[model samples]
Target chain A: MPSRSLWVPFELGRPLGVPDDADFQIGVLKSLLGLFNRKSGPVIEDYPIESPVTAETDAAWSCTIPLPPLPDTTTPAEALKQALLQEVGSLAPWHAESMRRMGRTSFGLSGLTPESMPEVAAFLADVASGENPEPLSGLSEPLPIAIRYMADDAKAYYMEAANEQPGSDSPGGTRMWTWIYHETRMGQVFYDLRDRLASEYADRMAANGGERPPGPPPINPISARFAVRPEPTAP
Target chain B: MVRLKDLPKEYAEGLLNLPIPDYGPAPWTDAPDLKDARVAIISTAGIHRASDEKFAGGAADYRLIPGDLDFAELTMSHVSVNFDRSGFQQDPNLVFPLERLRELEASGEIGSVARWHYSFMGATDPSRMDETAPRVAKLLKEDGVNAVILIPV
Candidate 1:
């Protein structure tokens, strides 16, 4: 518990409500700073405005970039790898445009550049297929950690490019997330990796008497959960 | 929206059932007026400079973000993928609000922006932060930060 806290009923990632709205953000700051005048203890105030993007649903939004058809391969993982690499290649120009305009991106969480995004996808595909490939670019983190970063970096790369397209900003991140998981081959790749990690995690748990073993298990199940968002069920 | 009724049933239940840490009695201090207060932002959004170490699962450490650091240089390596990163990707202000604070300073709403801000990855057990909290408080005091806004995402 904080001595003074202002609770805003915004979406999970957005604390100040909407992005790119200066007046609203300033208003939030004023509300928070105004708490100082109360001279009271442990004040937990609720912010009074509902974010415009709250529970925002964008059913009409879709990525404009068309991906090349997936190549047929004997191995399913290889097909995923090829398709993901092509997907990244197709989005490169738009991502570059977004970079030119924004001057920076959140795409390098895995220590790999946006140009190296295809490699990150390939790494995950390999892991998904049950091969323990050496860490790319000599990253010293364990396989689970590397997998988590690569997965995040993959989605980040795609979202940055999508943001460059028209109508990308309408409903905010949730819409983009819906598009990523429901429409793209990259989304399929995420599901495959999650399934692979889940198997490994179950084995670890079973060996440890149905409880997680201490100090970083061989596979972190959380990574698998983070890698994919399941399609929303019908009410 | 964060109202329990608005969230998915499982997630809302998880949050409701979470064990609230007992931090003993809440400490109280009267803050300086908004115009006289030097404010620092403390976010649990797992954001930091691109060069900083990534937060592993349940890691308790925090990162220092210089107020003047370029927004593009900031990145998030928070361990959870459950939250939306799209907002932060589109605008850093939604998470950090440094720009908003700067506007307030220019308008004379607050005394000043602290030269440094801090971020810690959320989802870490708060009890694990016991050792580091005091040190952060000391640093805030040294920088004349009489008020801090703890933003959770």
Candidate 2:
């Protein structure tokens, strides 16, 4: 049990309410911080307010801009890589703008410059083709982390492109990401790479006496030890 | 307002499958008065300064975020897309709440905010916490922090 904590009812990412809504955000913070006064161990308090966003409303959100089409199914791997390069080239300016607005970015892994996305695409294509892709120099992180950053870069490219329209916001970026990850050909390639890497890592771990390597698990949002089991159903 | 009961069936079912860590009994600790306590935030939000090394493979590594840094200077890089980033994207305070902490300090709600807060990639395997948490506790104690709020995403 945690010594002290507050459970905010917001979705996984947003512990507070809406961004830019200072009053609500502060209220939630104050309530959590107030836990300090309790002279006790293992306090778990729930934030009084509820989350304002819902799956129904979140699902209804969309980006106004359309993403570029995936390369033709029959396109050669080199051509596909070139197409991805073109997409990143077009999206670079917008990616920079988005980063500027956020005042930072999560990109820095793999040491692969934004211009090296073609190589990333080629790597994914190789993985998809059942060929083992060689790791790039200075890219010593686990394969999953490398792929995640590549996918993130792709998501950023698409998001910035969609944000070109006025009034575009985070939901718009979310929608763009959903489309890119679930609907595009490159997305499929990414999925394959992730699957292959995860299985390979699991095999390696198994061979190493089932000891996990020094990294996060393939999936996250690790649950607490306690769970609320449903009551037995009436016969 | 959204509640766990209100989650979609698929999501609710998925949550049911997670392995709950056995934290055993709740070990209670006396806390200082709110107005006299030096508070710090420990978030599993995977946040770090732009110039800091990115967390790799759910590494047990943590980043020390100076309490006074601008919210815009922090960024989330964890691989899990399970959580919604929209709110975080708009206002990092929704997850980190550093700005709000500063406000509380200014208003005397808390004695003071720690010079440094901490963050870890939230999706990390729970086993790693055994080694990491104690180290962080030592650092917080050394920094004179009397209260901590663990925000798990």
Candidate 3:
């Protein structure tokens, strides 16, 4: 397939070289479209352009949205649920702004809506309490995306509510997401949930005498060759 | 400059191990002259018009993107978190290239842009794509497209 594909060395999630570079983008398009001119069985072309951003640079970047005190290890399930509900309520404005900018999100894979976020909060709180809640229903493409968006938005809302900054200058979705996924207590919770889920699946596979599914390699933050900065400790 | 093959071992394994259909070499078809051919684009970036249903779970589904639609009216709903979306956020042309195709049409580099383009969420189950591809090919044939450019994200 390499002979038939045009390869670009851009980061995951970005197929084009960079944001806001029309000339570079147009060049890529021209090069790709040029493939049709070949009367050959297979052809592979390497894009010459280099992306200015690197994983190191991206990893080093952090969001400044302040976060509340970390939920104590002994935090009750009901308390966590209450906090998540409040976070969702706080994110209403930001979510609305995102919708206005990007159009209504098409992510409703859990068959869950913002109106039913309490159900989601309850599920997460249960997971946090080390309870094996029922698996999310409708495990599909956009459903997982929708659930992620919900989790991200909840983290953003919690941070914003805890921040000293005025509401007039709230961070955008990307910044909030970067911060939530990379730093903060909520990020840890999300990561923990992911790890637990992976472990459970692996156990299930083992029980069924099936091989565990392949997944992306784990991040090695301590590697000297590709050192990613340590995440900030949650307050 | 890591290509898809260079992705983290686990990620690459997941994608590389996807069940791809065993397809043989297709007979080579010479492209019509660029200045006379009707060109169309098909992207596996999971793009859809705002009015269309979002793609879900390796769906064997596709959406039609009218040639005249605005980039702002398009959105991506793929599940993969591996690609950088900044370029797409800034200029959807990075993935869809609707505007670039339009420019080529205006410049006569291509005879015309197809009235409709197609999109499927890439990184989907290959079997689903295998099923959907022929249907999309039929649609392209109906639209009289002479050349196709496939972009994968």
Give the best candidate by lDDT.
1
What are the iRMS values of all candidates? 2.9, 6.0, 6.8
Return the candidate ranking by DockQ, descending: 1, 2, 3
**Arrange candidates by lDDT, highest first: which order?**
1, 2, 3
Which stretches of candidate 1 lie above 4 Å from their native place? A54-57, A138-142, A168-170, A204-235
* Order of models, best TM-score first: 1, 2, 3
Instruction: Pull out the clashing pairs in model 2.
Output: A41-B28, A41-B29, A216-B57, A216-B58, A224-B20, A224-B21, A225-B20, A225-B21
Question: For residues A1-235, what per-residue lDDT tens digits would candidate 3 score against the true structure?
Answer: 2234678877554566655566777777778777777778578889887766655445544434434444554564555555555555555555555546545333343444444545665665566556866656543334324445445334423443322234333232234345555554455456555655556667767776896545532221111212233465534
Higher-scoring candidate on TM-score, 1 or 2: 1
* DockQ of the candidate models in sequence: 0.62, 0.38, 0.34
Best by DockQ: 1
- How much is the lDDT of residue A199 in candidate 2? 76
Write model 1 residue lDDT over A124-200, tens digit each, in one string. Answer: 77877788887899453655677777778778888888878775454666677766776677777777666777788
Q: Report every candidate's CA lDDT.
A: 0.80, 0.65, 0.60
Judged by lDDT against the true structure, how good is candidate 2? 0.65
